[model samples]
Target: MTAVTTRPGLAPRLTALTKIVELGPGRLDQKLLSEASTLLTRAGDRLKLSSEHTVVALAGGTGSGKSSLFNAISGLELSPTGVRRPTTARTHACVWGLEGAAPLLDWLQIQWRHRFARASALDKGESQLHGLILLDLPDHDSIRALTDTEADRLIGLADLVVWVLDPQKYADASTHRRYVAELAGHEAVTVFALNQADRLSPEELAELVIDLNDLLRREGVEHPSVVPTSAVSGRGVDSLKSVISSAVSRRRAAIHKIEADLRRLEQRLSQTMPVGQALSAPATVDEARRLGLTDALCDAVGVPAVGEAMENVYAERSSRWVGWPYPRWLAKFRPDPLKSLRLDDVSDEIRGITTGSVSAQAAEVSNAVQALADGLTAGMHPVWRTAVHRAARSRSSQLPKALTEDLTEVAPELDRVPGWWRLLKIWQYFLVGAFVGGVAWLAVGLTVPGQLPAALQLLGDSAALPWVGLMMASVLGLGALSGIASRNFVVLGASRERERLEREMRRRVAAVSENMVVEPVERELGRHHAFYSAMRGLSG
Candidate 1:
C-alpha cells in the first residue's frame, strides 16, 4: 500500500467513496488508491492461499547484473547473465513450488517451473527456498525502453523487489532518481543490494550498504533495507535469500503494498466530495421570488394593473425569503424594498402607481426591452433577430386593431348625448348671427329714401322714398346677411365638432392601450418568471 496513512473517521471516507462512485463511469478512481491498498490485497490473497511465496522481481538499468543476481538466488543460472542492453523479453518466473501449496502457485498463474526434489538439485535449482517466487525482469534502460515499462508493471504486482545494483555504478544518479526515488513509499516491499561485491573488502561492503541506506532514507525511505552480494563468487547470496524467506513468512511486504494501493484510492475518493462538509441545498423558488423576480417580471411587462397583483404576491411570499420577526407596528415598514428586498425603486416602479398622473413608464420599459433585444441580437444568434422582427409585426398589428375595436365599442357612449342639446348649441350661434344680420338689413333699407321708416312716410310726403331704390336696397341687404351668417355658423360648428372628436379619441386610445399593450406585457412577465426559474435550475 502507499506510505501515507488514512485520516480518522470512516463516515467521511465512505462519503468520499460514494461521491467517487457518483462521478459515473468516466472517473479513473482505482489509480487514486494508495500503495497500502495494493499491499493489503496481495497479503490477504497470500494468506488465503496458505503460501509463503514472495515474488521478488529484479529490475534495473542495462548491465546492472539483475539476471546474474537472479541466477545467484536460484543457484541454477535460470536467467542469462549478460552485459547486453536488454537481457530478456518475456518475463521469467522461478517458483519454489512448495508441497501442499500447489493451489497457491495455480492462483499465481506461474505454470512454467523448475523442480529440484533431491538434496543435490536443491542446492542447484533454488527450489523450496522458503517458497519465494523470484522473477528476473528485462533491463529498464534498454534500447527497447518499453522493457523497463514491463518491469515496472510487474513490480506493482510483485510482493517484493530486490533491486540489484553494482559496486562501481551503484551510486548512478539515473538509477536512484528514476527508480529508487519512486520506490521510496514501498520501502518495506523493496530492498537495494550492491551486486559484484567481490570488488570490495568486507569493511568497504559494510560502508557502501550504510551509505546507500542513508541515501534511501533521504529519499523518503525511513528504514531502507540494503544488502551487499557478488554473483561472481556468490558472496552474501545466502543472506539475501534469508531476508526474502523472512519477508515471505510474515507477508509484511504484500500487506504493505495493498495498504498503499487502498490509501491511493481513498485520496482520490476524497477529492470528489464537497472539500470539507456537504454544501447547503440549492436556491429555492421562494428565495428567487424574494429577490423581486416577480416584481421584475411585472416591470418587464410594464403593466400597471398586473404590477399591483405582483406586488401583493411579493409581500405575501416575502416572509419565506426574508424572515418576519417584528410586531404589527414595527412590521408597518417591514417589507420595505431597501430594508428587506434590497431592490432598486426605479426598476420596480416601471408601471405608474398614481391614479391620474401621466406616466411614460410603459414607454420606458419598452425602451429597456428594446435595448436588451439589441444586445442579445448582437451577441447571441440571428434567431433573436427573427424573434424581434416577429414580435414587432405582431405588436404593430395588435395596436391598431385594438384601437379601432375600442373606439367602436365606446362610440355609443359618446352618441348617448341628447339631440336637443346639440340643436340648442347650434341654434344659439345661428340665431344670434341671424338677428344681427336682419337688423343690419333694416338699417340699410332706412338709409335709402323708400327702403324703410314707414311711420316717417305717413308723417309727410317730403320724407317719401323711391320704390325702385327701396326694392334694390332690400334685396342686396338680405342676400349679404344670409351669406355672412351661413359662413359664421359653418366655422363654429366645424371647430366644435373637431374638439369633440379629439376628446373621444383620447378616451378610446387609453382603453385600447390598457387592453392591448399592458395586458399582454403582464402575461409575458409571468412567462418570463417561469422561464428564468427553469433555466436557473438547469444551470445548477
Candidate 2:
C-alpha cells in the first residue's frame, strides 16, 4: 500500500506530545513518560523528513517466501533464497541511491557485507524506485534469538512494512494474532502480499485472496489492499513496485509512521488520565466539618483556657476600680490571670509551652482532613485519587506548628482597660477621702475642749459631731450602691470579652485549615485540568 497523504497538523500534534512529555517530572507516571520520551527521541533521530529516503522492510513468518519477494521487488539477487524453514539469518538492505541513503542504512544498523546498491543504468523504468531502502528481515518465528531480535528491532523502526505471506500459511493463527493484528492503526504504511501464487489455481488464488481479506478485517484492518504475487514468476511484482514508487514520490512515509507511533502513545497514556472534564475541589470547606476542625485546633492551641483567663483578667481589673479601698490595695498582691498563663507576653515567636491536649486535637484535625480529601476524590479515577490524597496530606507535618503560630498571632487585646473603669475608680477614691475626712473631724471634736475664740466657735457649731456622723454614713451608702451596680456591668463585660476571644481563635484555626490542606489539593486539581486540556488537543 502507498503512504497516505501528509496530515495537515502533524508538526503541531508532535509538538503537543513533546510538551506533555516535558510535564512529566512529578505530575505524570514516571515509567510511561520515560518510555514516551524515548520513543519521541528515536522518532526524531531516525526519521528526518528532509532525508529523501524511505526505509521499507519485508517481514514474514518462516516459509513465507519473504526473501524471494525481496529479490523480485529489487530486481536483483541481493537476498539469499532457498527452501529452508528460516532462510534469512540477518537483515539485508538494498538501496536504490548511491550516497544519500547511507545515513538511513547506518541508522538501520545493516552490515556493509549485507548491503547492496542498484545499478544506475540497469533499467530506466526502475528509476522511479530511487531513494528506496528495501530490507529483508528475518522470520518472525525464527528460533535463533539474534535473528528474532533483529527482525523485531527493524520492524519497529521501519517507515513502511510489507508483510509477505505464503498462500498456504496466510491464515496461520500465530502470524495473524501476533504480528498483523498488532499493526491495526498502522494500515496506512502497511502492505500485504500473498506470495507463491503460482502454486495455486487462478480460482484458488482468488478464493485465498478473499479469505485473507476477511481475516484482515477481523484483525481491525479495514479495506486492506492484498496483492497476489508469485516471486518466481514475477507475476504481481510491478504492482508492489508501483506501491513503493508512490510512497517514495510522496515522501510522507516518515510522517505517517511517526504520526501512528504518536497515536499509539496517546492511547496508552489516556488510560492513566480521567475521561471527561477535569475534577475540581469544593468551592467552600464543609461548614460542619470546618467547625469540627476549628474546635480541634482550638483545643490544640489552648483557646478555652485562654478565654477563661481573659474573663478572669477582666474581672480582676474591674475589682481594682470598684472594690472597697482597703481590700483593693491587697488585690494587687494577687497574680494576674493572663500573666500567670504566660500568654500575656507580646512576641512574634511561637512559644514551646506544650499542652497535654495537643496530640488528641492533632488527631482530630487529621481525621477531618482525611475525610475532606476522600469526599473531594469520591468519583475520580484511581490515579487522581492518589494525587488528591497526596495533596491533602502535603503539609500535615506542619499543621501543629502552623496552628499554634496563627492562634498566638490573633490573640485578643486582654490588657485594654475600658474607659468606664477609670471613671468608676475616681468616684471610689473621692468617696473614700470623704469618709476619712469625716472621721478626722469627729476625733478632733471628742479630744479637744469647746472653742472659745469667736471664729472657732462659729466653725465648730456649723461642723457638729452629729453632722460628721451623718456625712460618714452617706459616703458608706453611696460607695456600697456603686459597687453593687458595677458588679453586674463587669460580669457582662467579661462574658463579652470571652466570646470575642473565642471568635478570634476560631478564625485563626480556619485559616490554618485552608492553607495547609485545601490550597494544595486545589492546586493539584488545576494541574489535572491542564493535562486534560493537552490530551484533548492530541485528538484534533
Candidate 3:
C-alpha cells in the first residue's frame, strides 16, 4: 500500500475507478476490476456524508481486552468481557446520542446494539462524540473459522478500526500479520490501543510503548499513534475516546478508508501495467514481409500471366495499326487478353479466378500477418498480445474477395488504346488505299495490248508506271517504319502498365494490412496507455 498526504473523497475516487474500468475494459485484469467495483459500491453505499454516524470497530485477537475496552468506552456491559479466552463470540454495537443509527448498524450487520445518551451536565464538551457507533467484534484469531471470518469482514467494513492489544500479546505474530500489517495505507483510520497497561510498571509501560512503536514502523504502519489504555483501571481509555472523538468530529475516517482502498487497488494495478514507458504501434509496416505477402497475392491473382497476355494484346493491336497491310488483318484472329480472362468486365461480381490459388494466398498472408503481430507484441502482456494478434487477423476471411475485386477494377486500364495508336491506324489505312490503286493502274497498263483508252492514258501512260511503282514502294517502306516504331512504343507502354498494376496491387495489400492489422494494434495500445494514465491518477 502506498501512503499519500492528500486524501481523495469517496466520490472522486469512485469516479476515477469507474473511468479505469470503462477505458480499459478487456485489456485490464477482470478480477481486479471486479474487486475494486465491489469495494467502490460498498464505500458509496456505506458512507453517507449527510448521516452524522461514524462506525468504528474494535478488532483484536484473544486475550487482547477488545471486549473490555468496548464496554469501558460505551459505559455499558453490552459486549461480554471476562478473563475467559475469546469471550465475545459475536459483534455488538453501542451508538451515542438520541439520533437514530439503525440504518448504519444494519449496514454493519450488527444485530445486538445498545444506545448511549449523552448526559448534558457530565458530558458538556463531549457533544462532538454524539454520532459514534462503536462496535466490539469477536476475536480475530478465534478457534472457529466462522467467528474469525465474521470479525475479519466487520473490520474491513468499519470506517475506523481500534486494534486493542494486551501488554502480553501486543507483539503477537498472528495479530500483526493478519491485521495490522495489511492496513499500511489506512494508518489514519487505524488506532493502536495498548490495553491492560495497569499491569505493567510505569517504566515498563513506557518501554513497551516504545517497542510497539518500533514494531509497527517495521510492519509498514508509518508513525502510528499508540495509546496506553487500561479497561479495568480506566487509565488511558479517555485518550482513546478522544482520538475516536476527534476522528468523528472531523468526519474524515470514511474518506481516508476509501482513499486507502484506492491506494491498494492502485498498487495492484500498477504491477500489471508496463513501467517507465507507454505502449505504441510500430512506426511502419515491415517492408520485406509486406512485399512477400504481395508477391504471394500476385501469384494467386495471376498477375504474371495477365502481364504476359497484356504484352501479347499490345503486340496484336499495334500490328493492326501499322503492320504490312496483308498480315495486319491476320492479327485479328487472336482473342483479346483481358476479354479472354473475363477480367475486362470490371463488374462487382468476381469471376473466372481459381479458388485454390486464392485460398493458398490467404494462408500465406495469414502467416505473414501472424509474424508481424508477434514482432509487434514481443515482451507485451499476454492479454494485450492476444488482442494484437486478433486485430491482425480480423478480416482474413474476407480478404480473397476484396483482393479479387480490387484486381478486376484495375485490369481494364491495361487495354486502354493510346491516341497515337489511333492516329497511326488512319495513316496505315490511307497507305493501303494508295498501294492498291497503284497496283491496279500498273496491272491495266501491262495487260493492255492495243492503244490505251483515253481515260486510262489520262490517268498515266505506260512510261509513268515506274513512277507509280516508286511511289508505292515509298508508301510500303514508310508503313514498315511505322510498324516498327509502333511495336516498340506499345511494348514500352505495356511494361509501364505492368509496373503500375503491381504498384496498385501492393497498395491494396497495404490498405488491407492497415485496416485489419495495424489499426487494431494501435487501438489496443492506445487503451493500454489510457489505462496506465488512469491508474497513475488513482494511485496519486
Candidate 4:
C-alpha cells in the first residue's frame, strides 16, 4: 500500500459496476432492475462501513508453508507449523487496532487476537503494519473437506488474498487449474509468495523467483510482486512485512476487494434488469379481428346476418320452453325474448372464431377448452389454482399449445359413431321395389276378370280375399324393412355431420383461446413465480 494515488477512473469503474448489477446486459435490463437494486443496497452497506479494517487472507494448499509465513508476518508462532500435510484446521484471525471495525469482525464471525509482530524480527527490515485484519486460513488441499470449505469461505469475505506456494508445487497443475486460474483477473487484490526459498541455493532461489513472477504475469498479474521467503532462515520475512504494511497504508487491496464485490453484484443485477428483445404480451381476442372466423361461421349456418338473426332465433326458441305460450307480440316484450324462443344462433359466431369449416370450428373450440383445462392442470396441484392467474401470465405460450391440443382432442371421440347408418337408407329402395313386385304377383295369381277395373273393390265377402290379405301383409312387412333402412342412412349422414361440426368448432375455439388468451399470461408469470409453491399442498 504505497499510497500511490488510485489508478484514475475509480468513479467510472463504480458506475459501470452499478449499471451492470442494476440491469445486467442490454437485452434483459428491464427484467433485472429489481435484482440490481438489491445488489446496490449491499454495495452501499459495504461502502458505508469504509472505516472497517481490511481483511487479507493467506491461502494455499497443504505443505505450502502458509502457517510458517503466517508466524513470520505476525512475528509469533500462532499457528502450528510442521512437515505434516495440513497444519491449520481452524482459521486464525490477527487483528490490528482500528476504530469502528467491530462490525466487520462480527460479520466474519472471527475471534479477535492482537497483532504482536516485533519491529526487530526482520529479514530485510520490520515495519509496523496497522489498520489490517490478517487471516491465516486452513489449507485448501487439506485432507478434510471442511478445511477447504473454511478457506473458501474466508476468501470470499477477505479484501485481499496472499497466495503462498512452495517452488515445486507453485506450478502444480491442480493449483493453477482450480485456484490461480479463477483469480487471474483478480490480481489487483492478490499477491504471490514463493515460500521455502531456503530449499534452493541463492542463485536457484533468485531464478525461481523470476520464473514465478513471469508465470504470474502470464496469468494476468501485471508486474506482480513475487517475494522469496523461508521460515527456517527468516529470508524475506522483512520484505513481506513491508509489502503488507504498504498495501495496508494505501488500501489497494481494500479497493480491489470492493471492486470484485461490485463485479459480482453487477452480474447478479443483470439478471434482474431487462435486456435484448422487449417482452411481448400475449395475443388478445381483438388481435384476431382479421381472422374473419365469425363471418365464416355465420355464412356456414346460412345466417349471414348472425347478430340480428341470433336474437330472433333465440327469442323464437325460448317461446317453445314456456308451457304457457305467449303471443308473438307479447313475447317480444319479455326480457331476453330470444331465451324464450330457445333459438340462440351464436353457434355460427363460435364457428367463425374457430376459423374453420362449421364442423371443424366446433371441434376446435371443444378441443381447445379440454386442452386448456388439461394444461392449466396437468402436473399442477389442486392448491395451485391460487396462483393460476399469475401462472397464466407467465406462460402465455401455453394457452396456444393448449388450444391446439384441444382442437385435435375431440376429433377422435366423435369418430366413435358407427358407420352402418348410410347402408340403411339404400335398403329402403329395395323394400319399395319388392312391394311393387308382390302386388303384381298377387294380381296375376287372382286371375281377376279382365284386368281389375280402375279403383274397383274386389274380393269383398269373397273367400279368396283371405289369401289376398296375407299377400298384402307380406308386402307391408317388406315396406317396413325399407323404412328402417332409409332411416338408418338419413340418420347416419346427420350423425356424421353433427360429429364433424362438433369437432371443427371445438378445434377453432381452442385455437382462438390459446392465441388470444393463454399464451400472454404464461409468459409474464414464468420468470418470477415460484415453481414449487407450498400452497400446492401435499400433492405438490
Best by lDDT: 2
lDDT of 3 at 28: 73
lDDT of 1 by residue, 1-540 (tens): 122122343224333333333332322334433332444445445545543556677877777777788877776667766676433364566666455445654555443443222234356644436556677777766677667676766766677888888877777887788877766457677888888898888899888888888888888777788888888888888888878877766655555654444454444433532122112211122232222322332343333333333333333333322221222236565565443443344224422222222232445434543443343233322332444334423463445444444444322121133353355435444544655575565567668776556634553553444553465455445544543454454445434544454455454454454454444444433333332232222122
Write one digit per residue (lDDT tens) for candidate 3, span 1-540: 111223444455567678787876677778987887788777766655325767888988888888888888877777777655443466777777535566666667766433344445136566767778788888888887877898888888888999999888898999988888887778899999999999999999999999999999999888798999999999998999999999888767777877887787777777876534443534344567556656655665556665655555555556655566655566467665557755444221212332222222666566666776777776666776787778767876676667666665556343467788788888877888888887876677567775356435775655765676788899888877777787788778767876776677667756765666666666766665666556656766
Please tell me which model should have the higher TM-score, number 2 or number 4.
Answer: 2
C-alpha displacement of 490 in model 3, angstroms? Answer: 3.7
Worst 10 residues of 2 by lDDT: 346-355
Best by TM-score: 3
| Runs in model 3 lying further than 4 Å from the true structure | 1-13, 22-31, 47-51, 83-89, 97-100, 112-124, 279-363, 374-379, 394-430, 451-456, 460-467, 481-511
Steric collisions counted per model: 40, 0, 0, 94
lDDT tens readout by residue for model 4, 1-540: 122233455455555545434322332445454544554554455455544356788898888899889887776777777666444357876666545566666666665552333334334343346667788888877778777787877776677888899988988876777777656457667777889988999899888888888887777556677778887789988787777777777766666765665554444433333221212311222334323433333233333233334333332332232212223336557676444444344544433434533333344333433344344443433333334444434434343344434443332231232343334434444545666676776676557665443213455445666676687776666555545454454445544545555546444654554555445434422421322111111011
Ten-residue stretch with the least lDDT total in model 4 = 531-540
- Cα lDDT for residue 64, candidate 4: 89
Off by over 4 Å in 1: 1-52, 85-88, 98-128, 264-540
